[model samples]
Target: MFFVDTVEVPGLGNRSYLAGGRTAAVVIDPPRDIDRVIAAAAQRGVRISHVVETHVHNDYVSGGHELARITGAAYVVPAAAPVSYERLAVTDGDVLPVDAGIALRAVATPGHTPHHTAYVLEEGGEAVAVFTGGSLLIGTVGRPDLVEPRLTAALARAQHASAHRLAAELPDRTAVLPTHGFGSLCAAGAVPTDASGEPTTIGEQAAVNEALVKDVDTFVADLLAGLDDIPAYYAHMGPLNSGGATPVDLTPPAVADADEIAARLAAGEWVVDLRSRVAFAAGHVAGSYNIEAGEGPGGQLALLLAWLIPWGKPVTLLAESPEQLAKAQRELVRVGIDRPAAAATGTPEEWVRDGERPATLARAVFADLVELPASAILLDVRRATERASAGYVEGSRHIPLHELRSRIREIPLGVPVWVHCAGGLRASLAASLLASAGHEVVAIDDSFDNAPFVNTPAADRC
Candidate 1:
């Protein structure tokens, strides 16, 4: 048997496979790009017989249905799935025959999603590996709140029972292969730790991982607290992954020239600039979102959307170069923003002037805060998702940077506004948006220290 793990860091997800003697293979949690899965199977002279989904994911689009459509492999899921799809569904105690001596057993593990399941691969009745999707991670368990609250509670309970079942029923030697690992928000807390920093043993996880089989009450409490606010786009992306709809072509559409990109931008299209923050800081088109893809993954897309465009607006692409725009489009799809407006065909300098917000805005806001009235609102326009994960300055009204345009009426124009994001990137963007709308705004640099905002000392009065 041969096993391969494909990590799609671009999509912030993972997929794995089990190849038996180069003739047949079973893929688990295939990424949105199914070509790679096919390519891997072909390399080993194997054909994919089954495409397995441990659970319906909410983070990125799933390729299971598409893979099955292309390869004619059976799309397998838990029998209890409420959603409809063209495939075979199995439940606990059910075993899928892969070969004369090899089989995959479906074990219902419903914490992340109600119908979530895991596969225990057995060879000659010996358990070799168990594919735990969101149910179990290296250092954590799936967050129960990914679904309805009532269902989440039930799944949490089911997760506790299912984890114990795996710990007791499977052999200690069974290799634990999960769909996600460190750095994924799907998990609960710190990643699983081993001496070598590689995947750890189930035995090690059971002993140290708090979510493995702890008491139900403690398990539920810990799971809920760490549940960070999901990105605004997830509401639109999850259903599309359940095979409900097709994603629009994200490839930058062919345009006549820079005017076309500008026309799209003028029509309120999302323009994502995938330049370095330093480059963007030096100059970028007005109203264009700066992802600074140069910044490492994880929060690249989130930072781009939360800061550049307000929530609930369509997306368009604007990058430093054509290659950068193409790269940014793929990242956008992962977060559910498809068919980004036609990208700027020419250089960044061709579309707009490179001037930045007057340094006076920051200097003015800081000076005003020292003697500002209590009624002067110090608004932190960062997304709720960003603010919760990394604590925010106390008492700041969080009208996400993107929503500032729509909700500007909510704020009294006379009150001073100071906005910010994780770093100063989005804050600067937010400041620009507020300023254009005739609001007195300043962008503050993120300071994670647990201190009150420098000027508004009384604002901290809870």
Candidate 2:
């Protein structure tokens, strides 16, 4: 009998798969940290026979090459993916046997990337499951714009065709396993769960996926309309994945004392506090940005820090414990932020220098906005798409959270800056950023849905 197992990287909103007969298996689209994949194989009593990548991913670095090297397995890549590594370059219709009756068949499904491919797994000469990767996600498809601005329109059309092709060719019961759309920015639109809380099959996809239901023209238009800003860090990911990205080093980073922390902060380096938003607001070393690293499945540390921080700047991670620091390291590596220049663990009391008090902020809800003086400047740091759809206070100035650091100069100084996002997490991060920049700040730690002006003229919006 054969079984398929998932290795989920919740932080990145992606899944790697291990599937095989009792004695052997193949790993599909693994994350940079391969230890989880190895442990998963060990638990199932299977020796890995192959490591495969569906595309040169733009969301995270691939662990395929390193996983294959460690297991002495054949690494498989799409025929058109340009890479320096030696691999079995698969074309459409090539079948890779996985011992006994299980095997993987390649199908060209390029849209997420120019060379993207999907793999169909068959048992006893019948298709059972297909790894759709970014091409065909849960309810939406991978955004085609990540590759190049010029190629976006064409790729959107291609994505529509690819989704239809898979639905047409596969049986109703064929399981559809995708790599994105589970809260990953790679998705072209919002993802919707089925009655089972998953878009589990080709039949389910046909019933709801826009690419399957709409004509190619309508699908492309709808997709382009819903596209969000690409994460700034995504530009580095494709090349890292395709150009032989080195395996990550997970050893604890060098410990930073208060002196080194102060030095780094003085030199304009990033000193990120990885504690919870609540704890971080109560107290933290002066000038440190709070990202709250251990947000689990819903965390945005990898996306936010990589997008907002000045690229390639040295970073020092500070957390409440050694374990949290290590977990944050793992999350960073998945997105190709390979190393933390230094790290520190302990409370704000331990992080701050002698004769200095820990920095603190006021965490307020939307109700508190009415109490602020008219001179208070409301800063909405949500994505443009969110502001357009969800509405915002009329006079608030806009700066996306990703662009806030670089655009800090544009925001007027010496004013009470009340910052907000769709939800509070980003606002907390933005609040810390504005505070670090010497502005008096308050984080609106409440949902936008709860805003008093949501339906009034104050929030009448696109």
Candidate 3:
């Protein structure tokens, strides 16, 4: 008998798999935190015999090396990948037997990267599931533009061919498990989710996935045109994965006093407050950025930091408790934002002991925007696709959160700016950025769904 379990790294928007026979199992595309995988295997009473990498991921750090080392598993990787580490390099058509009735067959499926492979798990001589990684996603293939600009067009074409190949070779009933399409930026476009918001199968996707139905040239053009700004941290992930990255250190960061934190902030280092948005808006250290450790939609620390913060900048973390600081550190390390320069945990009262007043921002809801004075500015910081699908408040200035830094000067100074995104997370971050730039800002820390003008015009009046 064979069984498979999916271990979701919700913060990173990727899923790793543990599949095995009764006695042994294989782990695929694990995140940097390996403890979860180990625990999952322990529960199943199976020794992990192999660890597989579908590709050298560009979005998050890989835990394959560390997982394999700890479990005494064969670290399996693509034969074409350039790495100095010891691993069992696999090629297309290579098959590894996991146990008496189960085996994983390698299928070369390159597109998201120059060297990518998908593993088909067969039980009792029948195909059961294919771990498609970034190649063949739930509703769309992985974006081909993460590599060099010159290779994007060619890789997109390759992506289309690879998708067709998988569809042709695999039976319709084969379960399609992918790593990139579930709210990750690695995909070319947004994929629809099931009731549980998890990805569906190859059979279901073939009927609905637009990429599968479009011509190769059209698909390639559309994929490239739809690409958004790559996160600055992505450039660091590829190299780190190719060479092995050290196992993440989840130890609590050393506590720093207010004086040290102030000095660091004065030095232009990021002093992030990982508290609730409500707590942050009420009071926080002057010059601190509010990311809110485990709040908002999924509250992915790595994704938000990578997308917003400039690369290689030193970061200091401030949280409400030692546990909060430790949790934030674990999430940040998965995306290679390891080892914050300093950390401190305390209430705003404790932090403001030096006769310094903590900064606060005005919080508002969508209803307040209706009676806004003409002098006040309403800035929508959601992505273009979000604005298009769910209409924005009319007359609001549109600038995505990722582009806010470069375009901050466009908003006039001395104006009260009200900032909002699909949810309150980006809005809080944007409000902090705007405030740092000397604008009077109000962050709308509420769900956009509750906003009356999402799908209708404003004149209709909630």
Candidate 4:
């Protein structure tokens, strides 16, 4: 009588679920955009009877409060979670009746947060699925360092215990549906999967999840060691989620013209180009940063822009068309980049100021940089882990993209910079930033695999 439907917010790499029997359903870990959850409930032919949260989210705002209000569903939150709203406070072993022979049983599973809970969906007293929100994930566990630095170590230990506890108590076949695993920053490390590469289970986790397979000490050490930079925007998500984040305002911002666009840039506000990296690299308005807009495997606009730009910086968007602008706006709001201050949609030529030419940037593959020039600076902008995982060239300067804005001055004014990331996406971002800063840049529009090719003379594998 019950079914589970995943509502994936691919941009942020999180999932909300709408699952229940024939006539009623419950939503877990919904995104800031509640309409998708509402639509899922309607499509399931069930009314939302309960809206549940496993924890106060740190990645995106929760739609649970508003969804419950809209549907008159019972709002369920973990007991003692620091939420400002009223909710059905459920603790370990608490059961919420769903339908005939169907129910959700809450199990206290901290580590992701002090009050994090995982819900076990049961049919006829048998575990059907476990919604492991930011806890035990596919091949890893929720990162424990999102909380205060002082609590990270303790939380890492607790994360290990929580995974073991879930594995020990639940039936091995119980489906493990985690909110953070499919590219979510909340996940600590890479996710390993079987040939199928699908959602995991308790049985599968025991072999692949470090938290379940390794001893607590080893898992904690490895997890802590693998921790990377957290998204800067996460600082606001927890407070907004707990304090009842309002519905996202994705209504299009007032459009801007070339004059306004130039003025915003001159005033030190961000005017991001939401075009393809190649399109951006070919030509764009002077000082406008390039964060290409798309939501596939290569789409890094939302994450990269929110990470690089100073929080609450006034933003103006430049896109090739209205459709591209709309999509980019939605992506921004998913990460709490609510309303853009102003926006413009047109070709790069349309955005150029009077007496100014559309600026052009150069792009090259790794092979093009074989013989280092005395006049050029080689910059590597990928995270430390990526550089470590994939080895670096001999003389490349290392400054990760996230830290590049504040550290821009370290690179001299007149020298030309040749920048590259693991792939071309981040290098394009770095290239644009360097251009805006008055330094000539060439984006290494090739994969890092080709870097080793340039070791001796020229031309290696891409």
Candidate 5:
């Protein structure tokens, strides 16, 4: 009777679990790190009965679908899930029989994202534990603003209602095993951890979680007050979870010759140099994007580089060999930038001699101080959720990146357009988009939680 809690940390995205008796196991809220889950099941010598998701996650790409493909297990999600979930969608009071004397029950616990649920495991007539995904964290509940538009009022009402429902329903003794723990962003307040910083209990959470204040109204109000900045990539995450678009895991077929690579570069293919910073600086293609494969699973900085590079342009991957390319692809897919083209033939020296063109673009941080004073217009290319989470830079026009294409005419092209996202990815993408439309533009990396904001060249920032 061993229950395994699979902790996929750091570069992996989110945590998950493999729980059950000897005959079968159930997985919850899987991230892209499917290998770990597979290995755990192998070690335990149990077939995974089903992959369960507590809610549609926005923090990282959900690996439940991919895991289901690998394990041949049932992919069970909530029926209230916004999109087509390709598997058995369970509703409240629904009991999924796993094996002899074991069953999983889905209890509707919305607020995180409308259809959120907490799965309770009943083994041999005793409720074992509840798999609280993002709904209830170590010391906090799920944020309602992830789906609900209004941050303050709307999210408050939703989260408050959801928490009260969970608190009132679940039995006190049910062991609570949640998807995210101490370090997860799902918890708004400081995560409650054990002495050595591990996931605490639900009983502990009920006692001290600030969001669960005295009454429903105050709890919701407090939730609305401290919402964090919703990542720019979140808007695309939910749809992908519900089977909107399949990720193209583009790994180059095989390593090619330097001359052939050089030819491709000369033909105007963008280079994505997946190498170490030292190696890149020593010698690399003139116009290649530097993203090292050694940075570990999902190099966040590397992913940020991918986001900043001009979208819609042909990308040529530059890695030492096919093995490196495979690793780079893993990193790229972790962040949703799938199927990057293989690197073209040739070393940096060869490409230089061939007179391949350098990728050119003007970059700036697009702060209102500079643009407003100079009579240039400042455009906010961040999402509504982002604006609600992290307040927009004062006086900046709000035109989210997704709507930028259609809303371009609203901005005067004659004046220099300054653009920015919550951090910098969307800003870079926005700047490139504006540049393609013939607007003189600059993208800036603002909202850095550290260091006094400084101005420098794009090369330095990149």
Candidate 6:
């Protein structure tokens, strides 16, 4: 019997899979944190025999090398990736036996990247599943623009062809599992889900995937038009993955005293407070920035911080406990934000014991908008597509969170800014950014669904 297990990286909105027969298992597109994959294999009483990558990932660091090293498995990658490390380079029509009655066949499926590949899992000579990676996602295909701006149009067209090829070549019931499209930035937009809320099969996708049904030209245009701002850290991910990123070191960082943290803050280093937005809003180091530690809709701490923080800037983490600091460190290292400059764990009161007062930001709910002064401005920090579909508050100045740092100057200096996003998580991060920039800001830390919007010209709402 053959079985498959999904390991979800919710912070980046991606999934890695472990599949195998009776004696051995193979890991597909494992995350930088390989411990989970190892644990899954151990639980199933199987040894991981192969670690496979679909492409050079652009979103998070890959753990293929580490997993292969630990398990004595063959590290398999597409022949086209310009990788510096040694591994088994595969191409189209390559088949490798993984275990008794189980084998993986490589299928050339470019579009998400120039050299993307998909792996078909065959059991007893029958195709049972295809790990489509970023090529053929749940209800959509991976965005082709992550590699280069010049290749986007051509690759978008290729994406259409790739999806059709998969549908025609594979059995209709072949299970289609993708590494992206579950809120990952790699997707063009939200992929529609089935009524059961599970990933649909190739046959279901052929009937409903928008990119597969449309002409190549139409699909390319739509895909390109729907793309949003690529995360800043994405530019650095490919190189790290290709060159073999160093193994993540999860050793707890050296704890710093309040004075040391203060000195670092004075030196213009980022002092990130990893507590709840509510706890942060109540009291925090005057110059600290609050980006909550654990899971949230906005994104994971590692990916979110990697995208938001300017590259190469020294960061110091502040959490409420040693465990929180350790958790944040593990996530941060996965995205190449390895080894924070320093770390400290304590509450605002403990850090401010030197007679210094902690900083605070005013929080507002959706209903509080009515009480704001007329001179205050509303700022919508959601993606362009989200604002367009949901109809944002009329007359609100739009600046997606990813683009907020560069476009901060566009916001008026003297006026109070009321900021919001799809949920309160993004708004909290934005509010802290605005506060750090010396602006009077109130975070609408409430669901946008509950917020009121003026019924005005559709153009203004969008």
> Which candidate's TM-score is highest?
2
TM-score of 3: 0.93
- Residue-wise C-alpha lDDT for candidate 3, range 168-223, written one tens digit per residue: 89888898989776678888888643325544667777787756889988888888
| lDDT (tens digit, per residue) of candidate 2 on 1-462 | 778888777667788899999889999999999999999999999999989899999888898888899899999999899898899999999999997999999999988988999999999979899999999998789999998899999999889988989999999999998877667888887774221244389998889888998988888998999899998889898888878779889999999988899999999999999998888889999899988786345588988988887779999999888899989999999888889999999988877789888989988898887897798988899998888777777678899998888899887888899999988889999999999889999999888887766533344534
Question: Which runs of model 6 end up more than 4 angstroms from their true locations?
Answer: 192-198, 296-299, 454-462
lDDT of 4 by residue, 1-462 (tens): 789998877767778899899888889998878888888878778988899999999988788888888899999999889988899999999999887888999999999888999999999999989999999998889999998999999999999999999999999899999988777889999863222345678998888888988999999999999998898988988898888877777787898989999899989999999888899878899898988898765677888887778889999999988888988888888777889999988888888867878888898998988655788999999888777666778788999999898999999998889999988988988898889888988899898877863333233236
Pairs of residues clashing in candidate 3:
none
Q: What is the C-alpha lDDT of each candidate?
A: 0.65, 0.88, 0.86, 0.87, 0.64, 0.87
TM-score of each: 0.80, 0.96, 0.93, 0.95, 0.67, 0.95
Which residue ranges in model 3 land beyond 4 Å of their true spot? Answer: 193-199, 295-297, 449-462
Residue-level lDDT tens digits of model 6 in 1-462: 999999887778788999998889999999888898999999999989999999999999999998899899999999998899999999999997999999999999999999999999999988999999999987789999999889998888888998999999999999999998777889876874222255568898888887778888888877888888788999999999999887888898887788988898889889899999999999888778888998434446886789988898999999999988988887887788989998888888777648788889999998998897899989999888788777778778899988898999998898999999877888888888889888999998888878786444366654
Tens-digit lDDT track of model 5 for 44-104: 8888999998888775677788888878999898887876757888998899877678888
Candidate 6 versus the native: TM-score?
0.95
Show the lowest summed lDDT stretch of 10 residues, model 4: 453-462
- lDDT for 363 (candidate 3): 92
Query: Candidate 3 overall Cα lDDT vs. reference?
Result: 0.86
Task: Give the candidate order by descending lDDT.
Answer: 2, 6, 4, 3, 1, 5
Q: Residue 269 deviation, candidate 4, in Å?
A: 0.4
Pick by TM-score: 3 or 6, better one: 6
Candidate 6: C-alpha lDDT? 0.87
Give me the displacement of residue 23 in model 1, in angstroms: 2.4
Position 243, candidate 1: lDDT? 60
lDDT of 6 at 4: 93
